[model samples]
Target: MFDPVSTPDVQALVYASFAQLRHCRYLLLRIQDPAAARRWLRQDAVMGLLKARGQLGRETAQDEALAVAFTHTGLLRLGLQEDADFPFPSAFREGMNQPDRARALADANVETWRWGDLPGEQRQDVHLLLAHFRRTPFDEQGPLSAPALQAGGLELVQSVPTCPAFIERNEDTKESRLFEPFGFRDGLTQPVLHSTAERSRRLQQRREIDREMADDSVVADGEFVLGLPNEYGDLSYAPDDARWPSAGASANAPPHFGSHGSYLVVRHIRQHVDRFEAFDAAHPPPREGAPSLTEQMVGRRKDGAPLVQQPMPPADLDGFRFRVNDAEGFQCPLGSHIRRANPRDTLGSDVRSGVANAKLHRLIRRGRVYAGECQQADHGACGHADGRRGCGKGLFFIALNADLDRQFEFVQQRWIAHPQFADLDNESDPLLGGRGEAAFSVQSPTAGTRTTGLPAFTELVGGGYFFLPGLAALRFLAETEPAPGPPAQ
Candidate 1:
């Protein structure tokens, strides 16, 4: 029987946490010696450090979180070349994505996309990635955990640079909610998905928000993980060793092929806090003394409560949908960030089509902010001291998905970057949807629909596309001995 309750593998790091992993640590490394690195991964690394998605009670008991992921180039470093058994997806195998291309939505050129732009050690020859998380908000980098420690065991390690991402607790509020540099309580809205029919039924029965999955709220697991049935009830296309004359094995025995793997995208995005505050101050809607001028543009209050339907938001504030109260754009403006990002019942033409489109482009976001100095409340004006080109701190955006183009990139291109959406002319997302000129429209009860003229608040620093291979695939790469002698041809 297919047991959806059992966590697949430590490599599939989709674990649930009670206290929420607040502190995140990232390490980038380059492998100069392949033999030693392979040995380290095969023998020393204990991947159980990160619990899987369906893990039961005791899995998340330990407070820390850790996971390992690698770029397409990283696989080549380990001597795992293109094979018939596992033909990697075209998006990754074709290499880094160029932003100017037709399908590209990210606001970065090929030059800005390189790791070289990163200051200090981040620019080193990066081949492998290790990320860690801790439970407490008041936390520091403890010891080198799991796979990272194993990386140290390798003899030919070139460079290791540490990057930190954390969530600052909203000290102003009695609640334990966390806020980013821009003062938005993130991690509130996320997609709930399931791997099996039984699991889906079980989730529907639970109905409780505290469980692993939700009822109709459950998205298809194939949207994120490989080798799972998607929203359309078909198996997602995955890298597999098939029947045709391929490089590797045929029989499915000890080593599973492409069973629990998923592609990961990491973007080191920078937030211009001072510039954002300055712009918002300069453009305070058309009418003076408007309530939540900035908040209306964001579509949500700083505390993460929605400004539309439930103005006085509930304690746990993310269950409600958009169609019921604000279909006519009377509450939340159509150009606001939330409406543009998700759309829900507020999509183009009609409500039925909007619901369908929303399902096609869902993302599993795992992002955290990286601030420089002013970590708390703003002082009514621009206040950034450590100026790295006036972009102090921002979110280290990360997401996991099966189809990069369909799920993650689609949301960026069609919804965010696109200017003309839902019959609106030349209007982009208020927060993330602008190259430079982002105009925001807000629906107010008194002053009618007010618009705010704003500039870009976020910039893409650098990022890479990586694949989180299954533990079985990891073992296969680790154990494969290098081919000897000269070329056959």
Candidate 2:
């Protein structure tokens, strides 16, 4: 029952490409007649157009498809609400204010983080990856077609302003940078796309039969992008008659579905690297033949593998190669920042059960690290360097899913902040866990383990939640706004 090549992994590859191609397009259409706008929503023509365009494969019209669909008003606007506890003392509303200060701040922040501490070889790899994800403007294509407004129909309104930071993280203001909120080198982990081959590979990796469930659950292609069917026998966001008053559904019926759309939560988190480093320096773990501060915090070397579990640290390798892998809290403390965030093998059955509760709740993370200065090769050796000044270091954490409450929030509030994890004294996330009123400490029990105390950090500047609508939704929105014309006569 498993076909490797044309499976979900391939679909994911195609879809990811599609998502990048589509980018963000916002639109503003003005209707000459109010009745026409209502009529447009009632018809199925707009929906049909979206379906047809989505069907086009990547190779054929990737560029054209993107050009035709995205707009300044429809796709580009991310509806973000300000968090109540943002720590910034000054209110800098516009992105362009005090150009020199913003640049200096961003540069200083980047310098302080010691991103340059990474070996030259590692730096090159990171730069290449960052460049690959960058987006370019649509210069090749001409302006898009303006919608015609018939009697009570729609026309183009004012052009929506472009927020360049939406696509790229802020490059100025060091203290308010985005990326690595937790301070680890690679703070975010991304999900692997499930293609048929990918599924087979996963099954083989877990040594599971094709039909039976594997160790790590395998998600079908539709569950993520198109929204798989749920146990309630209702599609997510389905506009059934009973559920939606607009569709004339019964009061008990489920709401109308927007299967193609997904919810995205984008947070602009600022990292207090200076404070974190200072704490590490002040509380130097009684080096009674203990593991170094870096090892104690991450449970691994810079290369990203288990150092405690491996007898011999891999030579010339950034990480260690473990002879054994243990999901239990022994090897890597359960509360270690990375373990708390992912818990891949630790939770086992509990994780599966959680997944079954709401299948559509799954989300994919696509994030980037922005730093103020390129880490110099010698930065990490002594650790006490003048903090860089800039507003361009931190994480641009983005989560995409169909249901916000079930997926993104569940992961953030439950697993990341859950206090009852096995073997850990408290519920502090190793990397980003400074929440409560006071600082807290957790003991990592291993050959060279040391107890470390983490402090509470605050989020100062950030944005809000946004709905990434489908192409059909954009056209519908374009045709609904009231038109500009001679004073009503």
Candidate 3:
């Protein structure tokens, strides 16, 4: 059993997915009145919505969780202004809709996003993101209803619910399984938090459970949380110029403003399920002894197993490393989706250094699969090109990182979208490359390289960068009085 005394003052969602609660509702909101919003944040209703890290293990199996995050505009609305004195990273300051950021992520026509408003668009300006996870079905009269939101000085921008088809329940064992719209098992591999790994280790000692079944690498606490030493033994901050507000601390003391907090990267990606399946059918395996074309592209089977030819014995699904087992890309192609996503000892000069370097760019993902009807009028029926009716499915991808530029952005730009990644020519991440006519090359030991067209299987419909403050910082934000304004222009 975990002792609740030493738990960090971080939100539960940062360390837990709340997988027991299969249902979720993503509420995008706009702050209508800053004063009223702050007042609402201080209310018991809001304070009790989500548990702290310590309170998580004490919760009942049927408990619901609500995690709140604010975008740059949301912070501004909540009275956290950006200036030299109170610094924020440029990525959060400029947001994901900027033209340069759009180019960086290979996102086309970001001005046409369905969620946040562009300069000239009529969509709502999304400021706050509330992720509500529960075991019960979505209720219209839930705490996040229009009336409740209005009481909090907020107005609903949009409500995205979890796709029912993405959840599968086994009647015999009474276990639940989650899969993305593309039929691949989702959330199989995740980085274990320092605190979580400690608890798991204790549990393992008590029950004597096999380590392979629960294999997860523990990352540096500072890699995902502020005010702690990261992999490089430095306080974590993105882009080198970002600063954490001291909050009136001594020179030797750590800053408290961003401590235990994390930056959350949220993206609404629409997956073209039918198109992907059709392309998979059209392009079968090139040779008799190879996996399917889509399997080669994804570097994993639909069951979430890696494509390594001979996986290490007694290792779990995420146990094998590319450099140690498949350095030549003969088994798992160098440019495959999973390879580019993590790389796993395949980067840097050698295996040991590559493993260490890769740890600096890791992300803790807490994404959920989303499917249903098309909400955006402009974006036609999810990802269908033939104008099909009632076809919408995608992923509500979220990642938590202390440094935005080093972790998430680096993975997206340098690894996933880079055409020359791993010395491969004109090849990007086969799954999320977003290129219309991209090609993927499969290296063969003797049969030679086989190439296939890698069309855009997913499209970025909406995205925003948010700061998920620590519980203490959230309270500070709630209680903070408005800063003195400059003289009216």
| Full-model lDDT for every candidate | 0.58, 0.36, 0.72
Looking at model 2, residue 234 earns an lDDT score of 40
Q: Which stretches in model 2 have alpha-carbon errors above 4 Å?
A: 1-188, 193-217, 221-223, 230-234, 239-257, 277-301, 306-324, 348-362, 370-391, 434-453, 456-460, 481-489
Best-performing candidate as measured by TM-score: 3
The better-scoring model by lDDT among 1 and 3 is 3
Where is model 1 more than 4 Å wrong at Cα?
A: 5-7, 10-12, 17-19, 45-50, 54-56, 99-103, 113-125, 135-176, 195-216, 241-256, 281-291, 310-316, 348-353, 371-392, 443-453, 482-489
lDDT tens digits, residue span 1-489, model 1: 224543255253543422245455566666656776776666542444544554534544556656667776677667655557568876666444443432366455445443621222334335676666655432323335434445544322222221222233443562245456665667766666655454455455554542321332457776776766777777677675332223354453223345577777777777777787786677565555333666776777777877665423343365445676676566667677777777775554665565666777777776556545543322112233433221227777777778888876777777777776655667777777553246766544566553545667777766667777766567677787645533211
- Higher-ranked by TM-score: 1 or 3: 3
* Residue 15 lDDT (model 3): 80
Ranking by lDDT: 3, 1, 2
Clashes of each: 2, 66, 0
Weakest ten-residue segment in model 3 by summed lDDT: 238-247
| TM-score of model 1 vs. true structure | 0.76
Report how far off residue 446 is in candidate 2 (Å). Answer: 6.4
